[model samples]
Target: MSTLPLFPAVIIDFLGSATAIALSFLALRYSWSLIRLQPNNFIWGFLFYFCIAMAAFSLSRGVGHIIKILLIFGNRNDIWHLLSPFSGGINTMLMISAAAVTIYYHKGLQAYKAIRSEAEKLSEANTRLSNSAEQLQMLNTHLEEMVEKRTKNLSESEKKFRNFFENSKDIIYFCDNDGDITSINTSGRNLLGLDPGTTKVNFYDLFCHDSDLLKYLDELHHNGFVSDLEMECKGKDGPTRHILLTANAIYNEKGQMIGCEGIGKDMTRLKTITEQLINHEKMASVGQMAAGVAHEINTPLGIILGYTQLLMDDFDENSEDYSNLKVVERQTRACRRIVADLLKFSRQAESFKTSLDINLIIQEVLAVTEHTLNIHGVTVLRKFDQNLPMVFGDSEKLHQVFINLFNNAQYAMVEGGKIIIITSASKEEVVITVMDSGSGIPDAIKNKIFDPFFTTKDVGKGTGLGLSVSYGIIQEHGGTISVKSPVEHPETREPMQGSAFYIRLPATGVANHENEENLYNGGNTGIR
Candidate 1:
């Protein structure tokens, strides 16, 4: 029974050994392939080497078992027993190698995991850095745009300030504490008659009156500013101007006042207009009084003149009574003449209008006054424009105006002088200029010349109503009369500097057909 069991056991041991060897070799081949694909992988390397160790272990055991079986069958039991211990020792060494390889693989795997985690962290950091760089670039672009916008706004603000400074009509000026003008706008320079190249000027010098400057400075120092302070300033080339000034002190960053900034509004034209209105009102009141006085006094003066003439007729030519009566008559006639002039000045007399040729009226007046002008040693020069326009005025009244002007001219020229009569026409009016070479009207009395009872001649020589009456008549006739004294004349054959009377009359039409033939040739016609 023992020998039969031994036969089955030997067969079984051979099959088991062969199966273990085959499996070991297959594991080794697969592990080597895994290692070749990932030669540097710790896990793959460890697995390949461990498989080699297992295969060696299986080979040693299986070969030893196979040899023992053969030896036993060949009756070599002693040699089999001796080789069994060596094979077992070889198997034990291979098992130890496999365990060492497993431990090494575990350490290598931990290191590889750590390295991978660090690489992931580094990649995330790089991504954040890239994002920050993109953000910084965007911020820089936005900053540039904001800077450009601010610069553009500042430029526009400067341009606006420049435009206001240059074009403002009111005089804008800046002056230092010493009242030395440091900066002035274009209007200020023009108003003060300053040249563009002039850098500095004294503000006090512009004031017409020292009192005005003193008051301005006092108020400014006391109040830190001045508002609507009226002052008169002398112009470099024109009449004194009126200005309303407003000023404020200029300060630096330290709040210390360094200068003054001022604005002056020119009010000269308004002042002139206001004065004219007042003068007109005064003249109207004077005219009303004169009209009433003349109406009351005219009839009585005429009666006195008639009675004095009768008394003169009753007295003998050589008697003292006749002389007294003659003096009374002369005085009465003078009073009547004064009353008549007052009536004329008041425009109380009725006027008849006609299309009168101004040139013809001038000629008639010159013909009538020729002897008187010659006696006064005055010469008359006529420059009548051909086809002179007609004037819508009473012929007799205009004739009287020319006669009065001639008389005045004759008186003005005590010494021999020329009287220039020029007639010219424009589309709007006919202009008659009566210029005389004589003593010019004084500037002080120029404004008062047209006032009733205002006269420059000797008391008995003038009623002072001639010009006043002429003014009223011209006004009624829709004309304007202006005078320029000490008239400037270009160098000519005769450079006359005296007074010129410019009469502008609204034209009626072309010259009357009947007077057209009498229109003298347009040239200087001398009359003495």
Candidate 2:
């Protein structure tokens, strides 16, 4: 130790101390700048703190070296040697920790660089989204304008179609495949006898001859179009109308027949006049013989009845002669009735057309025949509609018609039975049905029952002309009278014992027919 060069050694220790202090200060300053860059980051911030501690330890070590040199100058090398190991150990540990912190800081810097690059990409994507939003807004505005323009055009088209449909002069109609009227023009409704605001009505119900209607429906079903088809239809408060209709089948997009559409030209008045001319010609020919028939038949028939009555008075009550006289007298009276019917049939009386409630008419007829009905052991059941409208016709003539029908029903029930009478009305027509429970008429004779002198009764029982006269009277009133035998009672569900006579007549408005006072002004009828 004495042989050592003290001057040179002292100079080296001071210079090393100065270098350590300066380097420590520079490293500390660099680490502080790094701490500012990533102050909250664990990897970088902890690395900077560790490096700062290492710099401080290095600064202390630099001071320790200077102290050792001072101690060597004081000849205290043992004390200097004792602290040198401590200072060296601290410096080595700080150097190793700083190296580890440096590695971690480098890894964090790489991760931060990647995150910054990703943020730049996100900014570009946001710019593209803004451009797309502007394009979509322009497209939406154009679509709204196009939709508004199309809607206006469609509305105009529909308006034009509606005008054409409503203003046409001819009657136009649309019906379903089932012959239900779906839509009809004003003229069509008027011709078909429907009031304004009629809810729903069937198409085939408008036709007169059911056979003709059935044929027409069959044709339409097969062909899907009907051309120049002439048919009769009842009109609103009017007579049966003749119409020449042309129709086409309507179809859906799938080519199925959804409905039918048609136009009808009215020919009612013309057809009626033609038919009247024919009927008048026939009547004129029949009237020529009617007078001679009355004159020729009355004289002999009166003489035979007189002589038979005289003979009947002379003979005993139980004798064969009296029985023969009774037979002759019975036939003579029947002959008289036949002549009376002929006269009435030939001469069509002037119709007293006035509105009258049909249900009231039924009650009156029932009143007149109720005693006779009780004698014959027949029960009368009346089910009449409460809202039936008044019908237009002659009340006296109508009364005669119902009386004949009721008498016929009485005759039908030979044994104790039931007679059900029903009356109902629709917007256009009034219906009356007289049903009896008795032995039904055979179908073989139904067609001929209305012919003159046709009878299903015993020799003295029926004049046969009763039904014929009834048929003629109903026709004169511009009504229909039909019969159905062996029909099931709608309500009772029993097989009706006899026959049904269904009569339909035109319904007249109460306000329009001022001359009529017979109509029930309040309600139509009640069950009795």
Candidate 3:
């Protein structure tokens, strides 16, 4: 192989040596700068130092080439010598420039890395801020939902309160401390006959009498509540209504009086009913006492009438004394019958239970009433269903029920009417209906016809306990008794003409059969 050029070798050696020295100095400087940098920034900082060192080294090399050219002058014919050294120097400069370019590229890479790091940090901060914002937004949404829910709950509660305040049955009114009406319910408006939309009534002005208002207010203030204080209320109409007011004071949380609220219940009908009930009870008690006394007197009266009749028979028939004594005996016998009826009503007899064919029993009762019906000129119609099941009942009580109904029909038919007694059978019940065609019960007196001592008959004509005792006896037989009347006619379309009473008894094989037996045993059966 041909020997390599010495100058080129020398140029290569110098270039390599200079490169080594520059690299060493740059490495040291880079290490020093890196020592000052944060550990995270060390690598980028070292790269920057190396690039600056390389740039300085390229400049030095270019300057060194010019110095060498000025110091080493040679003959013109020895161009190779001059050109050769320059060529090496140029090559060294080129190498240094290339190294500087490499270093600049490295510095650029470091700057890019720094910018990227800053960008990364910014991105992380932005992500954190975005997450926080999202959380804040969710919190705001949750708070808003809570507020909406609370508002809805409050609205519903208000609606319920208003409903209760407006639709109450009692006459309700809210009054300010001055007793002026602040709010009134529909019932209150109705009670005062005030138009709900137009009339504005002051509560105090509704008092029938002026003297009662102050007294009521004072009572409410003193007691904080007043119940069942009865008074009169002036309605918009001409009439005044009796009312019972129950009032209470409204107080705030601090126990200070705020206003007054009152509930007025119309007591006019109730008071009348109470009075009637009281009178009925009193009459019933008096009837019972009278019955006991009459029972005691009946035995003596029977003895007296018996002796008087015997004495009258012994006397001459034409004697005036005998006629007088006959009259006395007849009147005494009538009084005895009345006393016996009173006793029958006052004392409820024990049911004498016996298995009886209901059809036979009804036939027997009709036979006994045949004479009476004939005398009243009332025709009797019997429609008995064949093969009716036998019923266990008190014969005496059942006889009494038939007797009372027959007699009532007889009395009702003063102008002569038809009486219908019908018996029908169903799957689980047996019904008996008694219909009268006389001027059926007057509407005004129909409800009270069964009440003790309540009779439409002239005094002494009726004991009045006939229907009542009959009602009690029938009820004790596990039977339901009800009355029905048409308010209007079917063919003529006029007002109803008569009433019918229906009695229903449970059939023998049903679950209620035992209830029938228990009822006949004089057990306390509730009202039918």
The candidate scoring highest on lDDT is 1
lDDT per residue for candidate 2 within 41-157, as digits (tens), equals 555566567768677777777787788778888999999789889978877877777787777776777886787677778888888888888888887879888888999999999
Instruction: Tell me the lDDT of candidate 2.
Output: 0.76
The clash numbers for all candidates, in the given order, read 0, 3, 0
- TM-score to true structure, per model: 0.67, 0.40, 0.48
Alpha-carbon shift of residue 230 in model 3 (angstroms): 5.3
Write down the lDDT of every candidate, Cα atoms only. Answer: 0.83, 0.76, 0.72
Lowest-sum lDDT 10-residue window in model 3: 519-528
Residue-level lDDT of model 3, residues 334-421, one tens digit each, is 8887776666666534557877656556667877886678787987766665546666688877888888888887887788876767
For 294-322, candidate 1 gives per-residue lDDT tens digits of 89988888888888888878879999999
- The order of the candidates by TM-score, greatest first, is 1, 3, 2
lDDT of 1: 0.83
> Which candidate, 1 or 3, has the higher lDDT?
1
Q: In the order shown, what is each candidate's alpha-carbon RMSD?
A: 10.0, 19.2, 14.1
